[model samples]
Target: MSAPLLIFADTILTGFDPDGTPILLEQAALLIRDGRIADAGTADTMRRRHPEVEAMGGRGKAVIPGLINAHHHVGVTPFQMGAQDHPLELWFAERLRMRDVPPDLDTLYSAFEMVASGVTTVQHLHSRAPGDVTAVLDRANRIIGAYDRLGMRVSYSFAMRDQNRVLYDDDQVFLELLPAAMRPVAARYLAGFGLSLDEQAQVFYELRNQHSGKERIAIQIAPANLHWLSNAGLEMAARLHDATGAPMHMHLLETPYQREYAARRGQGSAVEQIQRFGLLGPDLTIGHGVWLSRDDLALCKENGVCICHNCSSNLRLKSGTADLNAFLATGLPIALGIDEAGINDDRDMLQEMRMALTLHRPSGHHSPAPTAAQVLQMATRHGAATTPFRERIGGLAKGQAADLVVLDWDRVTYPWQDSRNGFADVLVRRAKAEAVAQVMVAGRTVYADGTFVNVDRKAELDRLKKWQSRPRTALDEEMAELADAAIDVVHDYYKNWR
Candidate 1:
């Protein structure tokens, strides 16, 4: 806990109301103590009442609740690792070409990007690595350790996928499509991720127990996706959720091919199948629900399930735009995510907010689109609800965690601005990462001006670049060749698919 402090801004968007609009207070100050908001009111009144409290963020700053990146993977994206933006299915093959970066370095690399953009918390979904329980646990710990060092809150999960390692079919079935010589190499690669359903469950429990006491870290469950898990694996996810009250984040119906794959299962829609296993509820969040139907959305609403919208990822990967308008009509709890990366292959929440703000408006003069307040709610409040840290890290209400971003007000409204334009609209459209003056989490400044308070970012980045420049090892050479040969087969299999 730090000493009591007050943050005064020219304007403050405190939080959202019951009707999902923003609650703005002008010339306001928030009193923070022991890492939580103690009070909020007009700057003059707050200063009069607590004249002795140390102050920050005067005149030129606009304060808002800290933004959350609800769904994310990898510190360095696959594109940065040499994989282009292929469609989701084909991209899985191209993903093989990515060279490995150590867990800590990979995590810190992205942490720097996220914090600079005023992101205070992240839901990190780690992809399945080729390892046993010990190796997997160590990798998770290293990632968590990175966040702790950076003072960022994180909800972390190791995705559990027991099948469909390469394509939508069984591993052996997909391997048969390759030449006999390549078959052995492919089989060897597939065998690398051989953790059974039980081992995967064990991994979740061990991680939850290990991080049980952490204030800034929460270990959660991820069932990979509808195509990635078997019926038994789905049941395991439900069992884990029931055993502990942890929230579950699952990827489902992200693309048309995924929708078709669900249909072929003969088990009904992906939502129905998951419901049959008793996984539908407020605690389960569906990632990238691009192809969900009206009925699917209805079921999700009835069950209190949340949907995380990855607007930029959908566009970049050629996954069609999600029906966010339909989602809003149903009143489902909707959040925003930067899965893999955003539209520009970076993690800028302000740019993502602008993308979503303009993307949903259709041709009709009165067509429904997101208001700036709603998008801000998605990035802050709703995003927090999808994680275990709900109620603790989202808003500026009294007793809530004092996590917020201070933006340079002058930069946001440069040269000229109209008084008639709402602050939400102006800020969402114009604010950039460069406009972030300071970011605070738990009442402590983690980033200010252009530097992280804790890490020497340039030195760390230089070290990573030097390490990656080393000559490829024998295994690296083998994997590169294998990826080249496998991509053609993978492409053909999906070309005529659905």
Candidate 2:
């Protein structure tokens, strides 16, 4: 057993109380024993209680619970890969052209970005991979292994979407509309990848059985999005959740087109359809509720369904802003997600927090806007609730995992403003990834002084770059062209919808 660690910082944010109030402490010290917080109190009091423990941090640092990213994809930044700023529907087709990289390389690439930005826990909504059952499970395991080795607490969900791979509706008509030469190419592109729904659920159970015992990883069900999934797919997801008690993450009404699809299908709202399938509950997390109506938000709150607000992704994809002020008014549990599409094109949670705080200020005086402290809680505790980690990893309390980030106060607050200013406010306004001096998970320092403790990030990135530089195959070029040819048909399909 290792000696207890006494981590002292200038300020500490204990996430939130049971009643949803922020717990702020000044000159706080936290004691870590056996990877869990044994005690947390004033630095002087803790120091007096545990005189022999090794100490970390000092006067110019502030410690807060590590940020939780509620929605994320492994390694494919759409804009970076030619899937530019189209609406979510069109962007899906463009993403078909993205070149595939090794799962491990892809996982590590984004994991590095996330950790550097002080995110310790992530909901890694796994993207579809091209493979048979064995190959797909192998890739999922590889992604999990990468996160495990990197010391990140992750909820790994194999994203399941069984329909509408190309357009909003059935793509047969879209395929017929395509040029003859591009038909086969379009068919190949539209032919979805990965295992069937049954096989995916089976693999999910297998993965849960194998890795649920690990301290840093959990498995969950992810129905990719409303339009992408069939009624049968949604039912399978609900059944899996019921049988396994695993949490679910799904993209809700992310765009105006999705709203139109739900209305056209006579579903009233996508939220209503999810409720009809018996999937609404505390164990479900809806991502990007940008187009959710007032009633939809109420329904989400009533069902205890958490909403992960992906502020940057919503804007980047041209999805309109979610009425966050209304969400707050409804007392809905909200969390933060970068969706791997941040405003700055990097997975920076600090920036995400700042954006969420600033983006929803337009609700005027009647609606209560989110404060910096509340946004921090959304990034930490609320986000943790969306994943399997839940109570174990979100906050700094006795018996909770000691996952936290220590920011250099001098670096973040260089101008040396008045100490009376609220620390959370200052942090949200000024903190950046560069200010993260140390990051710890499970009482161990995984990142400190600009280097990852368990992996050689630079070497891994170099290898990934080399792999990406390799020549593209004929099929890759053909698919890229097919995506271009099919974009117009996809657009017209939605345009012509009655």
Candidate 3:
């Protein structure tokens, strides 16, 4: 933390505190010493605080906290866009099958887009191929190195599942499991979900056993499904939680069918079962609680359980939108997520925020939708609070990790204070990826005025594109291929889902 890295902005959007407050230090200067914010005030005060400070100049710029993307599947391929819209279960299965089998570049491009759009922190709910955790780890190392260069804060967990096989071992039963009519429809449903139990454990064990930095490698747990996991699997999940004190993540209550599975198994609710098995608390971050009832939301609030709200994914997959109003009414912490590949196209959180604003329109209920400020709160403050790193990141405050974004207001021209335009509303409606001016991570400029600091992006993309284009060999194609076909068939069958 260098003392007095002097920075000035037209307006510095400070959400650095526990509450996401907008502190507009107009014409003010901030001095970051070493990396901590040493002092901030009018130019006069800052100068007095740091007489020998170096100046980083900027004018007419909007500075805000670097975004924290609470949920993402890093190995998102271009082919992953094959399944446009589908339900929850099928969507996950498709994702599971299509993982890191795709080229590493496809994933890199998606991540680059996220950072480019001003996302400075991301929690990757990643999936990788089995018997090849190292391959996935190697891939992850590449990605993390890139993130380091871009100065992004990232926490990664393997998308995990050891349950389905544990419960039902027969191939025919699995094939006949999904409705025959829905098979073709569901094919397009799944793609790049995450890794299996074996894969997840291997990755976790390796990361925990090997990682050396608090900032670099963070161990994470993802229990893919309660029904498929054996008692042993649950114990393993708990073991991970107990052993490393790392974070645990999963998808909970995103579909009606998941609830049906719980009912059939006499397990009440997946979240409840998970909680009973010691999987709830400040460390557990559940993604897409779109279908959770008020009671379920309350359980989360009571336990300090944070949820990653994937607004675009829920809408696109017809999983139903999270009742954000009810959730807020519960005082439950919530973070924004762009389900892998993104809601409409690409890994753009700005677009995700916009979709969240308008998706819950009643047939004509007519209420004022939430504002950009509201959604931004979820993405930055609430999102930061979801992970174990909450104390370190998520807002623009002195002494907080120096993670932030600078907006290009000159090009954006958004503050058209007309009859219907507020600056906040304009930011939500009109802000584009092009308007993201610069990004800083850990007090260093990772992305400045549209250039990344890490790896050679052009060369990296070229290699990944070439690698993805090459087909998987017959010997290497067994499980994931079968999974992909199943997902494709299921998605196609349910193309016109009710």
Q: Which candidate number maximizes lDDT?
A: 1
Instruction: Indicate the worst ten consecutive residues by lDDT in candidate 2.
Output: 186-195
Q: Pick the candidate with the highest TM-score.
A: 1
Off by over 4 Å in 1: none
- On lDDT, who's better, 2 or 3? 2
The TM-scores, one per candidate, come to 0.98, 0.97, 0.84
Question: Which 10 successive residues of model 1 have the least lDDT summed?
Answer: 477-486
TM-score of 3: 0.84
Candidate 2, 57-91: lDDT as tens digits: 98999998988999999675777777888877788
**RMSD for each of the candidates:** 1.1, 1.6, 4.8
How many clashing pairs per prediction, in order? 0, 0, 38
- Model 3 agreement with the true structure over 1-498: per-residue lDDT tens digits: 344588777667667334433456776776766655556787667767777878775676777777888888754543453443556556555553443444346556766888888887888776543345667677666656655555567776666665443112323344565556544433332223235556667777886666547563465677756655656777788888898888887787777665666655666677787877888888888888777876777788888887888887777777776787666555566788886656656788888878877775445566545656667778788888777678677776777877777888666674543536545566666777898888777777777767777756788677876775777654335445555656655555445433
Per-model C-alpha lDDT, please? Answer: 0.89, 0.86, 0.67
- lDDT: worst 10-residue window of model 3: 163-172
Residue 293 lDDT, candidate 1, scale 0-100: 93
Better of 1 and 2 by lDDT: 1
